[model samples]
Target: MRSTVADVMTTEVASVGEDAGYKEIVSTLLERGVSALPVLDGENRVVGVVSEEDLLHKVEFENDTSARAYWPPMRARLRARLSGAGALAERADEKAAGRTAAHLMSTPAVTVAPAALVIEAARLMERRGVKRLPVVDGTGALVGVVSRRDLLRVFSRSDSDIAAAVEDQVAEVSRWDRGEINAVVEDGVVTLSGPVRRRSVAHALAGAVCGVEGVVAVTNNLDWEIDDVAPYPQMGV
Candidate 1:
C-alpha cells in the first residue's frame, strides 16, 4: 500500500524567523530539543534550515579576524596572514552572534508535495543523505516532515497485535537490572526518567525504546545528577 507524504511526515515542526537574533535562534532550538529549525519568512515559507552545524559557522566568524578581514583589499602579505588559521576563526567567533539566518541559509529549499508517494520520499531522502523531508503545499507552506523512522511504520502489524508486543517488551525491560534507570511507556510516548552513570546508556535506552514497534517517540528524561533530593519532602524538613 502506497502512503502519501501526509501519512508519514511529522506535522508539528519547529520554525524560526529569518531576521531573528542568532542567540534567540539557538535558544529556541535547544528549548524545543531540535538539532535544526526551518527558517521561515513573513509568508511562513521555508527559506532555509538552521542546524547546529550552521550555528558553529556563525561562532567561528565571531571570534576570529584581522584588519584585512574588516577592511579587505589590503596588502597581499597582510591579507594572506588574515586568511590563515586562527585569524579568520577569531573573526568568525566575534561575528557569529550577529549573523542572521539570511546570511547563512542554503536555499531555495528542496520540498515535496503532501500527496507525494512514500516511496518517492524515501528515494529523495536516500539521494540527499538527509534524514528528514519536508512536505509542503504549492505555496511552500510546510505541512509535515518524514524521516527513516516514519518509513519503518510500513512494517507495523495491527493495533491489537502491537499491544501484546509492547506488553511483552515492557515486561522484559522491567526484569532487566536497572537501579536508577527508569522506563515508562504510554500511548506511543515513552519517557525515560532517571539518572545513569554514562551518556551512552541514556542514548542506548532511548534508542531501544524508540525502536520498539508501537513507540512513536522516546523522550529521554534521564539526568546525571551528582546530588539527590528527597523523594518526599518532609513538612518543613
Candidate 2:
C-alpha cells in the first residue's frame, strides 16, 4: 500500500494565533526548533503561515523608509529581478514595521489533506518552495504537519519488506509464476532477473516494481523472447 500523509505527519504541531506578537512568534519557533508556524483563526482554522522568511523582512528592510531609496521605476525593475515587486514590496515594507502574526504571515497557506500520498506532498513542497506543509482536515482546521524528512521515512522500510512488495507487484503486473521471475532487493534497490515472453512485458513489470513504495531504484535484467519496441521492417510495395 502507498504511504499517506497521515502515516508520516507529526500531529503535535506548534502553532500561533493571528494576534500573536512578533517576539512571541519568534520564541515559539525557537523553542520548538521549527522554521515556521501556522497562524490560526478564532475557530482554529489555518489562515496563513508565519515563517522565518516572513519575519526576516523586518531585518532586511529595517533601515528603509516609506519612500525607499530606489525610485519607483528602479524599484519596479528590481521587483522583476528580485521576485518581489510593486505591491509585494509594499507588503514587505508593511511586514518590516509589523509587530503581530496577522501583519506578517503569508496568507492562503498551501495545505494538504490527510489522505494525500507522500509523493504528492513532496511535489507540492518543491513547487511551493516550502520545507514543510500543514495537513488540514475537511473543515480546514490544522491537524498535523509534514516535512521533507517525513516524506523520506518511506525509504526506511526494511529491505525484506521492499522485496516482498516488489515480488507482489511483479506477480500482479505480469501474472508470471514465482519461479519464472525473481526479485532481489538491497538497500531499497531492486534487481529483477529472469525471462519474459516479450520485451514489453519485461518493461512493464520493471515500471510496476519501481512504483512500489520504498523502492529506491530498479534494475531490469529480464531476457525477452521478442523485441516488440524495435522498429518493424518497412513494408515494400
Candidate 3:
C-alpha cells in the first residue's frame, strides 16, 4: 500500500490564532523553526496557513508601493499633498501601523486531507506552486502541515541537492514523461532535460521562458523521481 501523509506528517504542530499579533506570530515561527502556522477560527478549525512569505509580503508590497500603504487609498493629489512631493514619504512613520497578520493571511485556504498520497499532494502543490499545504480534517481543522521542506524529509537530504537544475538527461528515444519535451526558444530553442515531479512545474517554468523577448516555444524531457527534487535555475531567462 502506498504511504499516506499520516505516515510522514509531524503530529506535534505549533499553531497561532487568527488574531495573533505579528510580533508573537513571527517569534513563534522562529522559535519553532517553522515557515508557517495554521490560523484558527474560534472553534480552532483551520482557516488558513500563514507563512513567512505572507508576512513578508505585507512589508514588501508596502515598500514597493509606499504611498498608498501609508495613506488609506486617498486621491493621488491628496496623497501628494499629505506627503512631500509624492516621493512616498521616504521614511517610516506613524501612519503605517494598522496592518496585521489577519490582514496578510490568505483565506478560504487550499488544503489536503492527511490520508492523501504524496503524489496527489505534489500534484496540487505543483499546480498551485505552493511551498506548503495544511493537512486538515473533514470539518477543516488543521492537523499538520506538509511543506516542500517536509517532502524532502522522507529521504536523508544533502547539501548537493539544494541548488536548482535547469538541465537534465532523459531517455534516448523512450521519452515517457508526460507533457511536451521541456525546451525554450529565443535566439534559439533551449531544450530542458531532467526530472520533474509534476507536469505543472515543468510547464510553469518553461512557459515563463517561452514568454521571453525572443522566445517561441518550449520542449520537454522532464521526468519524475519519487525520492528527490532537482532544484532549477532561479533566473527565468
Candidate 4:
C-alpha cells in the first residue's frame, strides 16, 4: 500500500502559539532542530507558518537605510502597487518591529492532511517552496509534521519487497502469470522482459510497475504479439 503522510510524519512536532515571542520561536526551532514552526491559535488550530525566511526578513530590513535593495522579487507587484509604496514600506517596517509569531508568520499556512499521500505532500512542498509541512487533522489541529526527509523514507523499502510489489502489480495489470511476464528488481530498478498478448498490456504493465513504491526506474523489454497501437485503415468512411 502507498504510504500516507501520517505513516511517516513526526507526531511530536514543536509548534508556537500565535502570541509566542520571536525569541521563544527561535529557541524552539533551534532546540527542535526544525526550520519552521506551525503557529497555533488558542484552540490549537494552525493559523500560519513561521519559517527561517520569515524571521530573516526582520533582520534583513533592520538597520538597513535602503530596504528596497533587500526586497524580494516582484512576485507580488500587483498587490504592492495596489496598496501603494508607502503602505508597502510601512508593512516592512512593521515586520521588522514585530515581536510575536502572529506578526511574522506567513498566513494561511501551507498544510497537508494526515491522510494525504506522501507524494502529495512532497509535491505540495515543492510547489510551495517549503522544506516541511504541518500535518493537520480534519479540524485543522496539528497532528504531526512531514519533511522532505520523511517523504523520502519510502525509498528505503527493501529490494525484495519492491520486487514482490512489482510482480503483483504486473499480474493485476496484465492478468499474466510469472511465466508470461518476468520482473527482475535490482537495487530499486525493475526490468521486465517477456512476451505480452497485446501491445496495450505491455504499456500498462510498465506503468503499473513504475508506480510501485521504492521503484527507482523501469526498463521494459516486453514484446507483444500484435500491434494494437497502430491506426486501422479507414474503409470508405
Q: Who wins the lDDT comparison? A: 2
Highest TM-score among the candidates is held by which one? Answer: 2
TM-scores, all candidates, are 0.52, 0.89, 0.51, 0.86
Sort by TM-score, top down from the best: 2, 4, 1, 3
Please report the TM-score between candidate 4 and the true structure: 0.86
lDDT-sorted candidate list, best first: 2, 4, 1, 3
Clashes of each: 22, 0, 14, 0
Q: Each candidate's lDDT (Cα)?
A: 0.67, 0.90, 0.61, 0.87
Residue pairs of candidate 2 with colliding backbone atoms: none
Better of 1 and 4 by lDDT: 4
Give me the runs in candidate 1 sitting further than 4 Å from their true place.
Answer: 66-98, 158-237
Expressed as tens digits, the lDDT of each residue in 42-131 for candidate 4 is: 998999999898888788887777755666557676577777975766666777778999998888999999889988999999999899
Q: How would you encode candidate 3's per-residue C-alpha lDDT over 140-225 as one tens digit per residue?
A: 88788787766644333222221112222222222544434443323334466656666555656566544332223456565644
Which ten-residue region of model 3 has the weakest summed lDDT? 157-166
CA lDDT for candidate 4:
0.87
Please write out the lDDT profile of model 2 over residues 1-237, one tens digit for every residue: 999999999999999999999999999999999999999999989999999999999999876665576666776677665875466777888898889999999999999999999999999999999999999999999999999999999999999999888877777755653338889999999999988888888888888899999999999999888788767779892
lDDT of 4 at 23: 95
- TM-score: the better of candidates 2 and 3: 2
TM-score of predicted model 2?
0.89
